[model samples]
Target: MDEECSAFIDRDGDFMEVMCCDYGFRSGASRMYQQENDGRIPKNAFQLGWDNFKSELRSLRQSIRFDDYSTISEANPPRTPMSRAAYSVGQAALDSLDAVDRALEAAQVLEPLRPRAVTLDGVTRDSESGSKLINNCAEIRSKLKQLKLSNKAMWDREHAREQSGRGVETPWLIKGVYLSLCLLLDFLYENRPIQRFWFLETVARMPYFSYISMLHLYESLGWWRAGAELRKIHFAEEWNELHHLQIMESLGGDQLWFDRFAAQHAAILYYWILLGLYVFSPRLAYNFSELIEYHAVDTYGEFVDANEELLKSLPPPLVAAVYYRSQDLYMFDSFQTSQPMQNPRRPSCKTLYDVFKNICDDEMEHVKTMKACQDETVSQDIITRREDGPRVGL
Candidate 1:
């Protein structure tokens, strides 16, 4: 669709000249504009040219939707020649869009087509996720089919300015990828392992590779939000209580153990955020990267970084179980952002990716508690020495 739009515009101007070229529409200099042979769609040229110009104009209109650019001339913004030229160009584009929308109404012959990536209603039936979620996922797919938009068409209007030599920030698709990943994360945590595995396989079966497209999108989320969302969502509906109960019983009836248990579980759930946003999300989606950054970057980033440092202070044995989990996360992040497929989720094992993250989170909580115990033991030893007359020989 986009290529067609571009083509119509590029060749539209010489429509009349080309239309009558072989029959002597113009004698010499004007013939340069007209091909002697029937080089293009003769009759369609005029309408196509006008339609192309109209598209350029519409692109400009969409851009001016941002209010920040308007106050430039009025607010004495950028007084520089380049800035002034850009402002002038933006205004001109807006005017052209409105004018062309009206004038070129008769010109356009080609209707816009859906973006190639928008197929499968954005996701497929998760028969791969197992029969349990297959129905549910199929329903979700049905819902999105009607909602698919041409907004993100590969010919996205966001890149319009770049065509005109403007250095504008073509909006990144990161937010879209982030949202898709979050959904994947959500489903993974919401469902059991079999269900999750099936869904990943379902994703792998899709026509387009969406991982790289989304990895760039998910990197900006808040550190804890995705993870926190994972924890809360599972609990939002009634929990299995079986897992909770089993863990409690294994702790030998200690209430303190229960407190620690719940905390650990809660923390463990947090890792799903990372898995969803970074590793498992699909790519045919968009969300505000700002929202993700707002949720993830500060506290969660700190937590992950700080905990890694704290983990270093632990005894090797205590750290050993969870240490590898953190390594997994590092590995996951590295793997997620690699080439063409950003966060290219591996087909077979990615189901465990979220699960491993969940485990890592719990392990970290355990480590934190162990560190506290170690500190308490040292403090107690000092107190005992003080009570014992503080090393009298010394």
Candidate 2:
């Protein structure tokens, strides 16, 4: 249906480009930009100043979201992201997901199937047991179908738009790193979009981590006190990415041992490299991140277009349900610098399609922020309490 519609362009040009299913038109991007910069918390949140109270509350809330999914599960579910036939399909998909849980439970007794490194723990016996375990896995896999994205031709066409130069130029070193990462991903994740997204989210969190680390270090040394606000915003950005990582995990993206090992190690290496780059020249670091983020936007955009049907059939992961519909949405709005000061983003997460769509839009937010950081005029006030940080959106 989306293939038949022209790209929706906002007359105001403040919203992200949305592609609605029923209308064969674009939608969500406009809603995401309807943001407000109101710095007030619940009137009774705390007795202290709203700013200080919200800051502490956000940190405490982040910790709970990561460490206490138990509490989140107990919270009431949000409004469903889909309805009618799509909702029924999502429910069926969720029912089928039980198969995944059962398979994991069945594999638990097989030490070889576990993610931990194999050791000399009762390994010399039980050939029959090993064969039995293999047969069970095969049976489980046979009952399940791997999810796949369709419409590759559309993806290719949209991706080609990125290939056409849009006035984006990069330094040789930055370009080299970007190209090398692309090659690495193509080699590792060919034909595996879920795992590829898992790796990308893992690596994507590093730049914000590095940025926050440098900001904290500078402040600790009394070299910079101005970046306090920026730190808060960056921390929120990192927190957002963390939820994205967890959502991918829940989808079983980290099932392969090699993939887990490779992504983790690469993330560590990337962090240090970004840290060094940030220390040497902040502009260069921001520039590098901008290029990477822009590419991420394209990649996720392609994935969404390609996988529309399969994704719409799947229910969103629990983590996504919590993050998108959580009562505490300040963190979500903090990272979207491009939205208006009064309207906050409230993206739906009813199906896997909506989840990935929101993620793609979030990447665009990061791209806008990174680009703002690169601008000299924008950089001067990004860390300060000003309405004009950077004008960027979908």
Candidate 3:
């Protein structure tokens, strides 16, 4: 099945690579669950609910896999140990949660016009039991208030501390663009980090695509051929962004129609703008990406630090486990331009915290690559590429 998907992807152009590869990963992850035996689920009722949920996900994946819209890309499908394995698992989990959400929505639609309070078996409104209940409710509310205040204070203090040495000073125009995006995202996704990250990754992949497009154009015109390896590195970088986007999607970042519309349109605009910049000056293009990637590194770092406790409580997504734990680290090392040639990255992904940490580290690698691209003497040897075979042909 994997080979079939890979072949299908390879037949398509580079433009379809990101989309098709993601679909293949999601489908492959779903297949993993489908292969598990019924004995894996405990006899408890709650365990049965989970088993049924997994079955539903399998069905959804099977349905989606054959759809024309889902099969529209042709690049080498990412291998089993690819980056952002969390996304593949998260997508299945997200669909399961969505099923629950839809059922709740339907229940709400069918609910009675007026709600009624029900008395407990041995309690009445005027009884001592009722008084105790009211008191308990009051106490619960007070604790919730205190908790919220404590959380708010912690976030504010940590955020300020994290901001102390984070930003990268860029050209005035680049700074303007960065500030505008930050403000716009703040306005649109206030207090919603997952959504913000989703939008960021969505737009983030565009610049790499722009870079590849320009490089391909230059090669086609017989103008420049030295960037053959650079294009592969950029694709790997874009591949990293693709997983980040999927992770955000699995977390319900694109749940709102307006958010989807905003991200898609923004991505389109960003691609075109970056393409123009690359056409005029590759340094400017790389500098802009460097700024954006640097900001991503800081944002993810702050998010992981501030939400360390909460993030740690969540299990690492399956795809994440596969990516970080699997033996193949070829694609994983392909984007890290800063790493010494002999010492490759081997980041962990034991928990959600580790996943975010790895993501931040990935962005820093992208920052390094972008900075390297700005240098006139960046050698192909410095840009990592797979030894097995060529990723693209010009």
Candidate 4:
């Protein structure tokens, strides 16, 4: 297995090497990798503003022009004189604006406060990251299609599993909301599996964010101080989900503007909802999270099984490799309350398949933790500390 994994990595390394030349190390599959700037100067405010202004203009022009404008040049002209004049004026105006922007940049009147280049850690720091990520993701999707993996088929299997058994008993309202959200996802992302996972991960972190917020509020009001450990675990869980979200993003999951807008707004709403639930009943909040986590486990499990061969053929995203194979796993072990503190989950990230498998396992661990929280037994679960070893706590 080790030899086979090495061979797979070696086989894919050539493609990545060539791809990286065009889309920097900070773009595409490796976009999420932290970039260190040794001596490069940061872009000034004026330069940044000009770039954004140009980008907006380009977007607006693209929206107005439905067809390709590239073919219309000196050799081939616009059909009407009015249209030709309009194009010429627009091009000249753009050129003048560019020249003015260049002059302003040369003057350096609006210098950036931070002139020195710094390490960029955010996954979406590079503007081209999403498009580049999507390019690589398209290849993976093509392979999956060749293998006959169907999103509808995957959804039906999960739906059948839900129908066969009562997974989690909750209030009618909670169950209704869960069902509605699941159905919405099925509808909105019918044939786009990666985008569906992206949306799921985007909202997945909200529960933990809300839980941490509520716990912090309780401590601030002096109502409780025992949840410090719980907050740590929740943060770890949020961090885990964040990586999942980034992994999806690196897979071109968030390439569409509509998808981003929808996922972000939904995440914010989910956060507030979870916060309200936590304020009223912590047990209920945990139960809600447990339901979602269970669903995630099933969804990812089905996805993995359905596209096993294709996934294994693709290389794991850089974010997955960094997170799963990191030297520091204190955060990773902190959330798995069901496992013995001494035995932490150290999942591999040799292929995309392993990444999804690890994520599925992570969601199952989340289910156990949520159940423990609801039953008030999480306090007894061992909390693993890097320096202090295993100690019983929340």
Candidate number of the best TM-score: 4
- What number of backbone clashes does candidate 2 have, counting pairs of residues 3 or more apart or in separate chains? 12
* 104-155: candidate 3 lDDT, tens digit per residue: 5478742222222233223345756565654543443232212111224433
Model 1 per-residue lDDT at 163 = 67
lDDT of 4 by residue, 29-134 (tens): 2344444533456589999789856644443333223222232243235678986898788667656655655465568753312222222223233456644554
> Against the correct fold, how does model 3 do in TM-score?
0.59
- State the lDDT of candidate 1 residue by residue for 114-206, as single tens digits: 222321222334445344333543343332222211212212332453366632221356555445654543422231222222222222212
By the TM-score metric, which is better: model 2 or model 4?
Answer: 4
State each model's CA lDDT, in order. Answer: 0.29, 0.62, 0.61, 0.69
Error of 1 at 220 (Å): 28
Error of 2 at 58 (Å): 37
Those runs of model 4 whose alpha carbons end farther than 4 Å from true positions after fitting are 1-32, 37-141, 144-166, 383-394
TM-score of each: 0.18, 0.60, 0.59, 0.68
Clash count, one per candidate: 26, 12, 6, 0
C-alpha lDDT (0 to 100) for residue 265 of candidate 3:
89
Q: Rank the candidates by lDDT, best first.
A: 4, 2, 3, 1
* Model 2: residue 145 alpha-carbon error in angstroms: 5.5
Which candidate comes out best when scored by lDDT?
4
Q: What are the RMSD figures for all models against the true structure?
A: 28.6, 17.8, 17.4, 11.1
How many backbone clashes are present in model 4?
0
- Model 2: CA > 4 A from native: 1-145, 149-159, 163-167, 376-394
